[model samples]
Target chain A: MKLTVTIAGVELKNPIMTASGTFGSGRDFEPYTDLNKIGCVVVKGVASREWAGNPPPRIVETYGGMINAIGLQNPGIDVFCKEDIPFLRQFDTKIGVNISGKTIDEYVEVAERLASEDVDLLELNISCPNVKEGGVAFGVDPFMAALVTGAVKKVARQPLIVKLSPNVTDITTIAKAVEDGGADAVSLINTLIGSRIDIHKQKFILSTRQGGLSGPAIKPVAIRMVYEVANAVNLPVIGMGGIMSGEDAVEFMMAGANAIAVGTANLLDPAATMNILAELETFMRNKQIEDVNDIVGVVNKAAISP
Target chain B: MNQSINRSRTVCKIISNRPLVDQVFEIILACPEIVKKVRPGQFINLYCRHSGRLLPRPISVCEVDLRNGHLHLIYAILGKGTEEFSGYKAGETMEIMGPFGNGFNLDSSDGNYLIIGGGVGTPPMVELCKQLKGKKTIVAGFRDNPYLVDRLKQYGDVYITTDNGSAGFKGHVVEFIEQRGLKGTIYACGPAPMLQGIQAYAKKHGLQAYLSLEERMGCGFGACVGCVTKVVADTDTGWRYKKVCKDGPVFDAGEVLFP
Candidate 1:
């Protein structure tokens, strides 16, 4: 019953982690569940400077999920290091800091700042669709993706995990590009670029008109992309999109992800990460699985063998 | 009272869920944890047990019966999430997390409390009015037919206005405020237009006002940063985003920038 999983030399007690933006450095959800029960807490995206984010009406409910154009609102590295880092350090779980910026220099600066911090890993965010600038740019293009990955890798003291944007022509190319750029691992998919309209008002639902779609609706696409990236790159893959339950996390692992991050589900249930972990363990016990790692990429083997 | 109340997720049994007016419903839940912590202007994020409705619907605390350990939530059938709530019946249960956001600061001033609420925003004011001492005047504006006037009457002198003039005062609530010349520290909530009108009215009279705002929210807690409103700042560029779910669902009337 070994549930522990290793990603880029870091060992997590379990495979369940909170997705960036959904869990704000583990402070918000502390009331509902114990932070020590989670394997890792992937906090919201942090930039070199404080981000004011976007205007109001930043989120809207769709059919199976929701859309958000938060524009990566954060308190910047200085405040995050001062406040969020110390708060998260009280927990037993590993810490994965998600970095966002409008340029390579901003990314490198934040990475360098966190270089001496007590974080366990650095998640390079090049695929945030809500921001107008650097987020989707580096992620959508292979060359730029590699360039940013290489730039951050130089200063990032923690093992770098490049998060890929789902709004791309070929995700594998970008995944390969980061691997070549010396990334320790990769996480996909950030979010799909989508929009919704208010028929009654005859206007876009989100103030930004377009937003990144997440939740159960994007789970299928995320699983597909994770499968593709895991096959294309040698790096370990952390899969996330719309993981709602323990079954969903297991599905992602079987599809070729070493671990899974719970995103929009945390919004619905604050204790989602711990609940999903229990569900994952229940899933293991029922299936007579000794090690959770035994299920990783198992679907691919079945698909190829037969 | 605990300064920092820990938010919890619990299954609250429904004591009653029935229509109050057209597309408006009143639900009473028996949850002591929520009833104990909830203050006026605080909200609860309600989860619809029905599958496919993944996001929680944020509803303000309309009333708290501490003796019975029951909490009252009044909401309109605005969309699918609420429509599902409309279908829930007594003996049923639903998941909820709360009492979130900074509740109204009850200690601001000693002036007569002018509690103005429009449509669904009227509910939270009921609780606020009940707890306040001294003179309390409640002015409520509805789209057409008014609901909850009787409950509001118990707390103070209740004034009513309807869009179609089918009720107490003819025309908009702001028009009623303009004509009546009511004097007090204004505590208001409603659509942006109504709040903007109140903000203007407060400025003209040199009165302090507090407004409760509504926005599309993700996590009812502060995590997602999806529910933000622009507020006046002192810097050269004069505005910054504050979480409506955390920094406020209630804000100083003069500080909010209504667009």
Candidate 2:
């Protein structure tokens, strides 16, 4: 049997979701994927207001990864609901809107507006740092996470999933605060803050100077954080970071995440999500696993008597 | 836009790889899948065979012999990627990841089509001309001789300008456009300075112009967001940033926010 997951009473065919911003508007990846087969698609983060994003030099490539300070450039929620959502409706898969707000009121207001729309879930991205404030602010502090999650929960009748940032010192403390504030579920491991200087240019590659680091370089860190957060909260945890293959996705599932999201891998291959799904099925079949859920957090191992 | 294009890496053989000019290579790869659907102004990200090569390099598809399933890439030896590529022999193979990036809009409804190119920018213009298939005038600029004269015949109604006057008109491509009283839609690609010159002249004459920008890119797709160019717009999203590899390597000339 296939793995199934429920978020706020909505059934997802699988437990894998594409992280926001990595997958362009759903239309870009639809050709590479059978949308109905995947569990969900997280659209690019839609700020309460449209964002122009950072200036040029917004991205720098590290050895195995990249850093981007795109500053949440997006068409606002209103445009998303009006212009973008219609396309998502055509896909049989669940559509999750990743939202960012610069202020508490903005979060509540956007949530209230989105409640009327047909989004299956709301992924509150409170970790974007390149913006004026709200992103990293809400994500870094326990109090801020609670306040923002609570504010959105008040107006949002739909399922709310707070996406946690990896920049925090204590991710569990922040995750606990959001859970306390009434968030239904949570996703862990947004990009870590990083920057690279072009020594030859004698300047930062990104116009913003600093951006979020992601890709295979951050996978181990993400797995650790997801394990920590899953241990801290009862909510279903969505895990991601440096996930390039289906085997990588299975590793995250074994690391204690209920579901996984693929981010940087999508950059290398637009058909990454579908490719991962196929690889996961093949792994499950080869391992003689009847259901995917049986492998989720199947990391308990007895010490070998050497 | 319902275009379903994306990126991939294919191990392709170098059918015929040779230098077109000093340090400029004309590499023909046997990539059947990529060659079949390639349009003008589109490019490929080639992974060079060296650890020192940091990322894949972008080279515009200069020509495509579709019937033969061959794609030609024209590039100059500027970095490790191209430098390493210069060493590869015909029949040797390398991983080619592309036919990535949006190309020029092929619509030629406007009567008088004007094209401007400088250096390597001339390659994409060749493809654009093939697509235009209309009455279009080309104003090509190069820095020196031999190079300008060698490729001038490929364009239609060509106006040539060389910095040293070793070629046709002794001025810039933009100067030639102004001197010739050029009009209608303009499509251009070149170094930033030349593009800036063309954009200014086009804006002054109220001509619709599209420019293909060359920005240093890491991932030649939307994923890295490395190749973003700012555009002037009238909305809250004051800056319109499009991925050169995803949304376009070609965009309206006036849309570019000249940096």
Best by TM-score: 1
lDDT of 2: 0.80
Here the TM-score of candidate 1's chain B is 0.95
Residue A93 lDDT, candidate 2, scale 0-100: 84
Cα lDDT, all candidates: 0.90, 0.80
Please name the candidate that would achieve the greatest lDDT relative to the true structure. Answer: 1
Residues A1-306, model 2: lDDT tens digits: 577866667788887788988876666556456667678888888877777777776766686777878888886887888988898888778988888888999888888989889888999999876776889888999998999899899999789999999997799999999999999889878999998887898988888888888888889999888878877888888899988788899989887788888887766566777778877888988998888877766664311232
* Candidate 2 C-alpha lDDT tens digits along B1-259: 0011232467889998788778888888998898887888889988766533436788888778888899888888875568889999998998777777878887758867898888888877776776676677888887774343345456578877888898888878888888888887898888888889888998899888888888867568665566778877787657677777787788888688878
Fnat for each predicted structure, in order: 0.73, 0.22
The residue ranges of model 2 lying beyond 4 angstroms of the native Cα positions read A7-9, A300-306, B1-11, B45-57, B77-88, B94-102, B109-113, B131-139, B142-149, B157-185, B216-226, B236-239
DockQ of 1: 0.53
After TM-score superposition, the amount by which residue A60's alpha carbon in candidate 1 deviates from its true location, in angstroms, is 0.8
DockQ leader: 1
- Expressed as tens digits, the lDDT of each residue in B70-171 for candidate 1 is 999999999888998999999988788789989898996675989999999999998998888879989999999899899999988999999898999988
What digit string (tens of lDDT, one per residue) describes model 1 on residues A187-289? Answer: 9989788899999999998989999999999999999999999999999999999998889999999999999999998887787887788888889999999
Docking class of 2: acceptable
Question: Each candidate: how many clashes?
Answer: 0, 2
RMSD of every candidate to native, in Å, equals: 2.9, 3.8
